[model samples]
Target chain A: GPKVLQIPSHQIIDMGQMVTLNCDPVSNHLYFYWYKQILGQQMEFLVNFYNGKVMEKSKLFKDQFSVERPDGSYFTLKIQPTALEDSAVYFCASRSGTNTGQLYFGEGSKLTVL
Target chain B: QQQVRQSPQSLTVWEGETAILNCSYENSAFDYFPWYQQFPGEGPALLIAIRSVSDKKEDGRFTIFFNKREKKLSLHITDSQPGDSATYFCAASGIASSSFSKLVFGQGTSLSVVP
Candidate 1:
């Protein structure tokens, strides 16, 4: 079974500050995704990445948010000038192929924007 | 437009009882459905999955009953145990679209199994 790992499992940042959440997807996986879940709410899609570019993003993926798979290494999601609404558990997931239809998710990064 | 919808927001069952969680989808093109279970402070994990080609898929105490025509599905946990308590999500996706593997998740159902 493949596993996805996230760095800085919990992060607290001041409003208007910048934060970068890192995801280490399975070594052999090709597709990566980010999702957000507010307290007691359903998980919502943020963005999906493949081939070093964003394939699709939801409305929740704000303009201040950006994702990159730099150097084929870590898949990072950066949020600039964070807002109170940004408080949530951020999840990173990956799949071996596009049609496998099963995603392996990381423990998640809990972001608290004050 | 929300694609996947789940019900019961929460459920409680005694040990050895059966727990059922419901889900429905709006997309007729969605052929793949998977159920994920998550414990507090942990990520979602795949519990069971069923394709539209089949009506039922079972693995251990976990089973998924899918109705392709009605675009509905359900996860049944038999002989439930205290450890079976967790939040379950039903997700759907198409086969070949760019969002092929992208999962549209249900709100989730919180299940509590009493000892």
Candidate 2:
């Protein structure tokens, strides 16, 4: 089975600080995605990237949020001047181009903004 | 408006009993439905899925019954075990002209199998 790895399984940061989360998607997976999940709630889609460009994003993707995979390296999500509401478990997912509708997700990085 | 909805926020079943979780969607264009299973401190994993063209899909003791006309689906776990206790999320996505579409998830149903 394909595996997606997320760095810093848990992070505690102060509000208004900048935090960057990294994800190592499955090998040969072209499509990447980021999802946010509050405690005891459903996971919300933040954005999807393909071909080194953002394909689609939801309203939850605030202006402070940015994503990039430089030179096909690790896909990173950066949030500057974070807010308290931004505290949640962020899961990174990737899929192949086969259109199987299956998105392999990582264990998720839990962000706690205090 | 919530495009995907699930009933019974929490459920508890005795071991060896069958547990049924219900799900429905409001989007007609959503042709793909996937059910994800998640345990505490872990990410959700794909358990089973079905397309609009099919009425039923089964794998092992897990089965998905889809009613395309009613825009509803249900996952049935037969002979449930303690290991089956987890939160199940129902997700839907539409494959438009492109091969990629973001999935919309429903408020998950937490299932607890008691021995």
Model number with the top TM-score = 2
Question: Which 10-residue window in model 2 chain B sums to the lowest lDDT?
Answer: B95-104
* lDDT of residue A1 for candidate 1: 72
Q: Model 2 over residues B1-115: C-alpha lDDT tens digits?
A: 8999998899999999999999999999999999999999998999999999999999999999999999999999999999999999999999653676998999999999999
Clashing pairs in 1: none
Instruction: Candidate 2: give the clashing pairs.
Output: none
Give TM-score, chain B, model 2.
0.97
CAPRI band for model 2? medium
The 0-to-1 C-alpha lDDT of every candidate, in the order given, reads 0.91, 0.95
- State residue B115's C-alpha deviation in candidate 1, in Å: 0.8
Q: Which number leads on lDDT?
A: 2
Q: Which ten residues in a row have the lowest lDDT in candidate 1 chain A?
A: A94-103
Where is model 1 more than 4 Å wrong at Cα? none
